[model samples]
Target chain A: MTQVHYDKIALIGIGLIGSSLARMIRKAGLAGSITIASRSGHTLAAAKALDLGDHYTTDNAEAVRDADLVIVSVPVGASGQVAEDIAAALKPGSTVTDVGSTKASVIRQMQPHMPSHVQFIPGHPIAGTEQSGPEAGFAELFAGRWCILTPLPDADPDAVARLTRFWEACGSRVDQMDPEHHDMVLAIVSHLPHIIAYNIVGTADDLEMVTESEVIKYSASGFRDFTRLAASDPTMWRDVCLHNKDAILEMLARFSEDLASLQRMIRWGDGDKLFELFTRTRHVRRSIIEAGQDVAVPNFGRNVQAPTDSAKPD
Target chain B: MTQVHYDKIALIGIGLIGSSLARMIRKAGLAGSITIASRSGHTLAAAKALDLGDHYTTDNAEAVRDADLVIVSVPVGASGQVAEDIAAALKPGSTVTDVGSTKASVIRQMQPHMPSHVQFIPGHPIAGTEQSGPEAGFAELFAGRWCILTPLPDADPDAVARLTRFWEACGSRVDQMDPEHHDMVLAIVSHLPHIIAYNIVGTADDLEMVTESEVIKYSASGFRDFTRLAASDPTMWRDVCLHNKDAILEMLARFSEDLASLQRMIRWGDGDKLFELFTRTRHVRRSIIEAGQDVAVPNFGRNVQAPTDSAKPD
Candidate 1:
């Protein structure tokens, strides 16, 4: 267990990331008391039901009143509103951070509302499943994942170090990056992939010739992989696309240009060019596996499951 | 145990599908003897090393001679060549089927060489992992998956029935479709997904601002799902693209148009449209899970593996 770094920790939104952080903080004894708040009554009650924190409230300001560390874990689109809600209640020297996918947008939304005394550190953990909500969280969510901190140039180093320690206690390796650069990097790595997945699933669903049943039945042929990503929280993704407009548009344009070239190769029956691209992409998966970002098991180990599961392959 | 459906079964091309069929046939006693053949001596040797068949040969004709059933599981581009090589040696009343991804192309390529006395049915098993080769095969590969057979209008019913029995013994639900329809359906379901995956991975790799290390480190946030499909066998995909050009190109055009519209929505900050598309696609994943085409387990059950693996989280 880690040291009790904060006397009180406030989680502004008790969803997947917030609840997960609560679990990890509790497990590691990093916080003496945790306060959880959610805009939805059902989510707030669920957090209380799960015993996710020491205090629970639907009022974001009430949760942050006595907290030394406040983490805003709401959707990117809600970051500014959340910041304004709790800005008056933040402690004098408390450290406030957010776990949002789009760093630049989150910083822009939350930075202005922060008090002059509190240090606002924008952070993102590069880990999650397609699942969401309070019960969808687990203590291991951030384990072995990278947690990025994009602090303002004038932010206090001591406060940044403390936040770094908290993430480390949660089993994440922390890295610092400029928020703009972080946005560009994430556009290629995360946002664009999700956008493409959502787009492809939409395309398949709208196809009159190929029925949805056929798409699902034959999905094991590769379509199902995209479905998992496409099935992600729609609100969160919609917010991401809206908030990270410039970077996402840039990546989308690049992706479309590349796809057009690939289409040209297929149209001309240029087997050699098609083969080259297909072959090169194979190595990227290998690199991801080697880097421990993904497992090397075939079908992502889907073929191996508990014997009692009805879907287990016989 | 299922009854032995064929006295002798010959498998041409000991890759993922061929070796898997050999394993299933052996497990169910579906064949009295199994003969495996591949163009590469290395593949033949690997098949022998795995004891995948009773007899192994690099020569397709020698393997097909006197065999009651021949399943060609080579790259689709090689279907015609294999049919030509085995045509003279195929038993008079035997059934020859192929597990190629594209049906119309396979029929166009193999029909001219098929002997009138033998039955030629083009088939595709809507199942596979990214991994390929002999060692990747398992007896349960076809279990709970769909096997689509596209037979000629004049094909013998008896032969088709026997092939259906064989696939049933291997634990698959069978479906029949016109070859052209099959091509169009597969273009949307299989070929297009793989192509998009390969294209996105290529796009990420080509990004100058986003280092490869950044992509790998942050991959768990949706990018990794596409990597698994992108890592599929290049030769097989290249062949699929070359042989099923028209259908794939048509699907690509449809996909690009839809993507362009989605891009417009993002560009114009149309959150409702984005949310509508994203929400609609979630039902497709639900349908796939309900149909037993995919497991509903989170992260595809990757979180269940033992903790000792190097990639384990904490």
Candidate 2:
């Protein structure tokens, strides 16, 4: 009883998102055959153990051969290499996409490598937890999250619509925007938050005056929230920073400027400004909750496994 | 059925933490009566609606008339006023404690106003969410969290132990630290995180280029986490920053230094440094979960209405 959305669906780079997609595709019977490829032999073996796909390989080209759909889920740094490695074997009329955090750079890296026959659509699913690796994936990961497609001006609408429908079935709201806008938007919401978390945690770590136990004990107050974000997979985040330098830097500069003003408020005991800013930020969280983007509590993993229709436990 | 650890417990400033104490005290039969006092008529009305206390008053002095145990849970900025307001009415042998975020200032502000007849103990419970107000409080807010007490050098041992036991009955693990050190520790964990979140959200708001839709739509990536912290009560956090200035500034400096180093890593493409810091931060989350400071999904409000002897809910 497979839905069979594609003749063959290929996944390049079987990490958290990739593995989850593979599993969802299988669960939904969305493909006749699935080929999984990653540069690491160990991950491929793990995929085999889990039987995440019908075929597994280390060679990107071997994985994509004759496939009707190809999804590249790798570090932004590796997008160019993966695009180059798999270009020759990508079948004519196949729809290709990459779930990279930074869309502009991915398009820049992968577009030139496209063999003209494949419809290359650069996309990002605004979904993930701090955890990574094949073992951390679940079928419901994409459900209720957003899938952002950054299609080239010349890209065919039918191909985009088909990909959008595929993500919808996997449980995602789809939106398309210019790649540059996507990059800048991600810089503020995703990249800036991460950089700040990493910075604060690293700062606390190096303090000679405050003992480690103190920070850990008091972390739940607010610092612990940053720690969860700071704990996100580093390799992927570093690539995001490297690949989206201009946007990230722009966002950082703005953030530092805002922080300096806040620091001034504290230094001068300007309670009104601090209070107003704090109160206004509350509305943003309300909007997100209203939009159903976040769980009520901080630990999303538990929310995912809870007996809620929103999170379907296997 | 009142276990009545104390004949009367008075709560000054019945907001999130205070109301929570009222709930837990009633449920556990730990106090013969819970008396809630707040400056705002609106807040007092809300607390009354929640059935959090047996008696309510607008005058702090009137509320503390015969209290055996009095907890002042006001903004750190308002600590001096609350202390001065209630100082004259405190019972001769009563234990007067606080649930303020900062201790040094709380003691400095309140000690001078307090009578020699009462035992003055400064304390804080490191438990909260972005939500505030009386209605937002849950009896389980302090479950498995920490309550830090900074007793004076000459404070009575019996008073300290009894107060510690009271918080313990509320489901908190109690610890002692120097007031100055406590401020320093909280600066890095709670204050800095909230400050950073506020700054980043403000920065996003100031952006003329990226539309609001982009920020909300893409927040799931990382920024959404910061919004939760940013949404915290303004008066509470603003007072925390002003009251804990010296420590907050020190932590801020360290944070900036680490951020500069991270910026250098990104600018130079030094992936390994970023990777190490990122991976190391992940362990802290694990530790927090293990310590039960955080749920596995990390933010489930505890099942407080259930009997304490029952095992944690599945």
Q: Could you give candidate 1's per-residue lDDT for residues A1-314 as a string of tens digits?
A: 33338999999988889998898888778888999999999999999999999988889999999899999998899999999999998999999999999998898888899999899999999988888899988887787789999999999988898888888878778999999999999898899999999888989999999898899899888898889988899999999999999999999999999999999999999999988999999888999889877889899977653323222222
The predictions' CA RMSDs to the true structure, in order, are 2.5, 6.3
Which model scores highest in DockQ? 1
Q: Against the true structure, what is model 2's DockQ?
A: 0.38
How big is the RMSD of model 2?
A: 6.3
Structure candidate 1, residue pairs in collision: none
Q: Please give me the DockQ of candidate 1 compared with the native complex.
A: 0.59
lDDT of each structure? 0.88, 0.83
TM, chain A, every candidate: 0.96, 0.93
Candidate 2, residue B35: CA error in Å?
A: 1.6
Off by over 4 Å in 1: A1-4, A305-314, B1-4, B304-314
Q: Please provide, for model 2 over A1-314, each residue's C-alpha lDDT reduced to its tens digit, 9 standing for 90 to 100.
A: 22228899999999989998987888777788999998899999998998899988999999999999999999999999999999999899999998999988898899999988889999999888777888877777777778999999999888888888788777778999999988888888899889888888878877888877777877788777787777788889878988998888788778877777888888898888888888878888777777766766533322122112211111
Error of 1 at A210 (Å): 1.1
Q: Of all true interface contacts, what fraction is found in model 1? A: 0.70
Interface RMSD of 1: 3.6
